[model samples]
Target chain A: MIELQHVSFERQGRPILVDVDFEIDRGEFAFLVGPTGSGKSTILRLVIFDVRPTHGVVFVGEYDSQSIRESDIPHLRRRVGVVFQDFKLLRDRTVYENVALALEVTGAKRSGVKRKTLSILSAVDLVHKRDVYPDTLSGGERQRVAIARALVNDPFVLLADEPTANLDPETTDQVMKIFAEVNARGTAVIMATHDLRLVERYGRRILRLDDGRIREDMGLVKQV
Target chain B: MGLLLAFREAFRGFWRTGMVGLISIATIGASLLVLGIFGQVVAGGYALIDRLQERVEVDIYLRDNVHRRRALVLARDIEALPGIAEVNYIDQKAAAQEFQDMFGAGMLRALSQNPLPESLRVRMTPGSDLPQRLQAVSDVANSNKDVESVDVGETWVGALERFVQVITGIGLLLGSVLCLACGFAVSNTAKLMVLAQREAIEIMRLVGATGSTVKLTFLVGGAMQGCAGGFLASMGQSYASDWWTSRVPDLALDPTIDLNFWLVVLGTVLGVVGSWASLNRVLSAVSIK
Candidate 1:
């Protein structure tokens, strides 16, 4: 579960998030819809304890922004998977190595890392491209690899910031299906995007952010 | 698993930064090579000084009226002194014979009577303070009524001691400055290597990688580069020393195996320290929180 209570973030005295408040229970998929510079990324950053709120507190599982030590940030990250718009994969490594790295950083056993990485790669339908480098992959494939790397650790929540922003409509649908499958298996997902059409198509709960404030929160819509 | 991952990442980084890695290693190697050469020069200079010190002996010439028995007693008394290692009584006949051997029998045949005085050839201990201790021994020998004069080679021995002191002082000061410069060079090169991989490091931190794990990766990489530099420097020093000795046999530099081993170890330490310093500055600037 994750919660941000009356959180406000400022950079160089400029307000990024103005007294924002939100809570998401476990196993839920929600869309954080906002245009560029609307503080969607900052919200996710706060959840991962990458940056502390200028005022108020954020709670992700047992970690509190106000109380968590600097050394415990890595442990908090292991439980919260993240995917970026640019698909931040190490270009020098193969797809398999990129995914395995998530587990390796956690000091996972070799056997567990290999087995889990292969399983995640298979889930994302990227097992066949496991040995290829990211530079050679299609935009959709690169995003899928990033997703697999994020999910390989079986994190309770996945934070995706415009994960399909660079993909074509067809590739976007394919990547959305992967998120749907992951959520179906009981992992909460908070996906940030500026695309309103994509939010309507998914028919999921929406938290529309505008100019550093949460303008509206539409409860979950039943799929047609 | 942590250690293995560190090693793997370190080697991967070392390979990934190809040209930068090579430059770092080369910088360290060149610095160490200069240091190694200087070390050998100092070692050789000390060796030569030691050889010169070994030949230092006091010649106490006895008067013409002094009997052989009395000269033998003087030799026994000088041998009992603190710094004296050995004292041999060279009687007038033996001194005459030695002079003949040096100038040939013809020079001694021209002399109607032997004029060489009986002397006590006194040798000091190896580590006894030169010039000062030699002066003390001369004073003690001169006090004997039968002795006419004492020759302790005071001027040359004092000059030799001063030379050793000057060389040692200069060697230490220059060696320290050179070592600090080399450390700075290696550290800056390592900083560049780390900066080149800055994005990768941020991603690692963004993931679940602990600070220590990330540091270990760089530390291991730096140490490997340093070790390679050390090996190169050792080889370079040996070859250069051999070439030098071939041209100038008097300055033969024979650095022991122990010295080479320590050079390699010093290289490794420098690499670790450089990496640590770079990591501290870069890691602080690029904080995740």
Candidate 2:
């Protein structure tokens, strides 16, 4: 589960997010929508400790920005999956290597890393491109590799920021389908996007941010 | 497999950022080569200084009324001093012979007696060749019974010792500066390699990869580059030094095997530490969105 209680983040004396509050329960699918500078991405970063709130509490499982130790941040990150809009796959590495990296980095056995990576690659429908490098793959294919990498560790919650931003509609649907499948399988998913097209199509609970505060909460995504 | 994977990633990283890898190795090699050349010059300079210091000797004069047996005993006792390397006793008759050899006979006979006193020609150990050590020996001889005086070429010895000390000081200062320069140069190179692997790092971080695991690959890559640079420099320097010795003839520079070993170790440490520090700083500054 992820929760942000009245979290406000400031940088250089300027407010980025103010009085923002929300919570996503286990196995729930939530969407964070906002225009430029709406603080959608900041909420995801707060959960991951990339940026700390100027005030208030941000919690993901047992980690709270209000109380988490800096040294313990990495361990907190291991239990949470993150996907980037850039499809931050290593250009030089193969599809398999990129996904396997997640497990290998955690010091998983070679056999386990390979098996899990293969399973995730198959689930994302890129099993045929396991050894293909990102540079040679289509943008959507590369994004799927990133997804496979994210889900390889079976994190409790997934935070994805604009994962379908660069993909064509057909590819976007494919990527969104993968996200929905991941959610249905019991991993809490919070996706941030500026693409309202897919937002409406996916029809998940939406938390809309306007001027650094939540203005709309559909499906009561805020959680009572 | 984890460690091996890290090393694999490192080598892959090094290859991917070919230009940065080359530049890092080049700078590291150049710094180490500078250190190697300076070492040779210092070694050669010290050898020359030692040869010059060898000519400075102390003469222990025996008293005019001292018995011949007592004079010889005093000479033996003086030889036992820590700094004294060799002590040759020149009896009055031998002093007379030395004068005859120097001035072509007649000189000692013309004086009607051996005016030159019996002496002990003492050579000091190389390590104890300092002017202060010579002064201490002279003081000891002056305090001995049956010993008339201790005469050392004090002015020349002082100047030579000072000259050697200055050269050694300069060598030490330059060597330390060169080492620091190498460390910085290698660190920057490792930083570049870390930057090149930014995408790989982000991906690793996303999948629950611990910070250490993210850094391990970069460390291995940087360290391997350093080791390669060090090996190249050692080979190049050793070849150049051997050629230098052949040309100089009198200055046979040691093979520098020990220096080579240390350079390789330094290169490895510099690579690991530099990459680790830079990656940690850069990664902490970034977050996956």
Candidate 3:
């Protein structure tokens, strides 16, 4: 479970997220919809412990995010899967190595990591492109590789930042389907997106942000 | 696992920055070689000084027309002194023969009579009090009217001792300064190489990698450069020493100094420390978010 209580963030003397509060329970799928500069990425970063809140407390499961020691950050990170909009993948590495890196950094044994990495790659339908480098992969394949990397560690909660931003409609649907399957399998999913149509089709809880404030928190209707 | 990843990353980095790696190793090797050679010279100089100091003894020349029995009695007394280890009485005839052997066979024969005095050569204990004990011996010998002069290589020994002290002081100062410079240079070179591959570092950190893991990779790379450089430098120094020894023929140099082992240790330690220094600086600048 993730909890954010009156969380605020600042960047270089400018306020970014102003007293924001949100929560996602275990196995609950939710949407974080906001404009380009509405602090959606900041929220995800706070959850992942990459950035600290300026004036609020954060709790991911049982650990206090802001006050936890630096040594414990890696353990906290392992419990959450994060997908960046740019799909940050190592250009020189093959798709398999890029995904395997996530496991390797955590001190996973080689054989076990290889087995788990291959399984995750298969799940994202990227097993066929496992040997291909990021430069040669298409945009959809790159995003899928990023998703597979995130899921490789079997994190309890998945946080995606604009996962389908550059994809075509069909590929966007496919990526969403992957998210839907992951959420259906009992892993809580919090995705930040600008696509209203996809939210309507997925029909889950939606939290909308505007100018560093949460404008809407509502359940979705059936997309008939 | 951490070590393997570090190795893999370091190896990749070394290969990627091909010429830079080679240049770093070459520079490190040359610096270590210079250091190793200086160490050998300083040690050799110290050994030479030790040998000369050990050979120094007090020489008591007997006065002319003094009875040999009275001089023998004085030599016995000198030998019985606390610091004196042994005393050999060189008779006038033996002294003349020694002079002839040293200068040439005819040099002593040219003198109509044996002018050299019978003397007592007194060897001292290994670590006997030098100036005070020498003064004591001189005092004891001077009291006897039969003794004419006491030679302890006065001015020459004093100058040689002072020179040894000066050389040792300068060597320590120079060695410290060179070591500091080597550490700084190696760190800066590693920093530049890290700057080139910073993006890879960021990606690794972004995905739950610890700072130590990243640092270890750079440290390993630096260490490898150090060890390789040290070995090469040691070989070069060994060859140079060997060639010099061959040409000079009589110059004493210990070939079993284990220079290679020492060079490798120095290179490896410097490499690890330098890489750690540079990596810490670079890691501090990165933001995971």
Candidate 4:
């Protein structure tokens, strides 16, 4: 579960997020839709405690922004997965190595890392490209590798920041379907994107953000 | 698992930054080789000084008419002196025999009579004030009625002492400067390696890896480079020592295994420290996009 209580974030005298408040329970899929500079990524960053709230508190599971120790940030991140638009994969590592890194960071056993990494790669349909480096893969395949890495840890919440920004329409659809499948398997998903087409197609709970404020909260509705 | 990961990441980094890693190793090796050679020179100088100190003795020559019994009594008196460790009376006959042994029997045969004087060889106990003690013993011997002259080798011994002091001072100053340069070389290597892996490091931090985990990776890499450099330096030192010994047989220039092992240890420590310092400076600037 994630909650932001009247959070206000400012950077260099410019307000990025103002009085923003929201909550989403476990196993729910929500789209945080907003235009450019609407502070969607800042909210995701806050949930992971990458940055503290300027004026309010954020609660991610049992870690509160007000009291969380610096040493506890890594533990907090292990339970929350994040996917970036650029795919953020190590250029030197193979697909399997990249995915296994998620488990390796947690000091997982060798056999367990292999098993979990292979299983997650299978789930993301990237098992055949296990040994290939990220530089050689197509845009969609790289994104799938990134998705597998995020989900390999079985995080409770998956925060995606414009994960499909660089992919073609067909590839974006494939990526979205993966997110949908992951959500169906009981992980809460909060994807932030400026694309309206995705908002109309998925038709899950929508939280519209504008000018550092949540403009509207559209409840779950039927898919278009 | 954590240590294994650190090693794996360290090797991976080495492989990733191929030439840069080699450069780091070579830099450390070169620095250590220079240091090792300097150490050998200093060690050799001290060894030579020790051998010379052992040979130091004062000789009190007696007048030609002094009786052998009187020479023995003078030896006993010199033995009772404050700093004298041992005193040996050499009569005219024994002194002549020594002269024959040193300059050959033909030189002694050329003389009409045994002209070498009866003498007492006095050795002093080892102490910081060796030159002064030798001077005091010489003065006491000169006051004796039967004594003709005393030779303490004062001028040469004083020169040797000054040489020891000069070498020690120079060794400390040059050693400090060399060590600082070696540290700087290692620190620059670590900085370059960190810069090369900037993206990977940022990604690792973002993926929930602990700060220690990420740091351990780079630290291990730096240590490996340093250790390899040390090994190389030790090999070079051994080779140089052998060449020096072969060319100059009188001087012993062998480097012990213990010295080599210490060199490697020094290299490892420098590697770890250099990596830690560079990481402190660079890690802060790396932020998640």
The best candidate in terms of DockQ: 1
Q: What is the interface RMSD of each candidate, in Å?
A: 1.4, 1.9, 1.4, 1.0
Each candidate's fnat, listed in order, reads 0.77, 0.75, 0.62, 0.54
Instruction: Evaluate every candidate with DockQ and list the scores.
Output: 0.71, 0.50, 0.65, 0.68
Query: What's the best-to-worst order under DockQ?
Result: 1, 4, 3, 2
Distance (Å) between predicted and true CA of A10, model 1? 0.5
Residue A134 lDDT (model 1)? 97
TM-score of chain B of 1: 0.90
Model 1 over residues B98-167: C-alpha lDDT tens digits? 9888988887789898888888898876563666678778888889898899988757756766776787
For model 3, what is the error of residue A19's alpha carbon versus the real structure, in angstroms, after optimal superposition? 2.1
The TM-score that candidate 4 achieves is 0.91
Task: Tell me the docking grade of candidate 3.
Answer: medium
* TM-score of every model versus the real structure: 0.93, 0.81, 0.88, 0.91
Interface RMSD of 1: 1.4
For candidate 3, what is the lDDT?
A: 0.82
The per-residue C-alpha lDDT of model 4 at residue A60 equals: 91
Clashing pairs in 4: none
Question: What's the true lDDT of residue A30 in model 2?
Answer: 90
Which regions of candidate 3 fall more than 4 Å away from where they truly are?
A: A220-224, B65-86, B103-113, B123-144, B154-158, B247-259
Q: State residue A24's C-alpha deviation in candidate 3, in Å.
A: 0.7
Q: Output the worst ten-in-a-row residue range by lDDT, candidate 3 chain A.
A: A215-224
- Expressed as tens digits, the lDDT of each residue in B21-121 for candidate 3 is 88888888888777777766666555555555566689999889888799889988887777776888899889888888888878667878888998988
For model 4, residues B1-289, the per-residue Cα lDDT tens digits are: 8889888988887887788788878888988888877777666656665556667899999998898888887788777777777898888899998988898999779879988988999887665577888877887788899999998876776686687678767777876776676667677777776777787777777778899998898888888888998899989988888898899978674433356787788888888887887888887777777
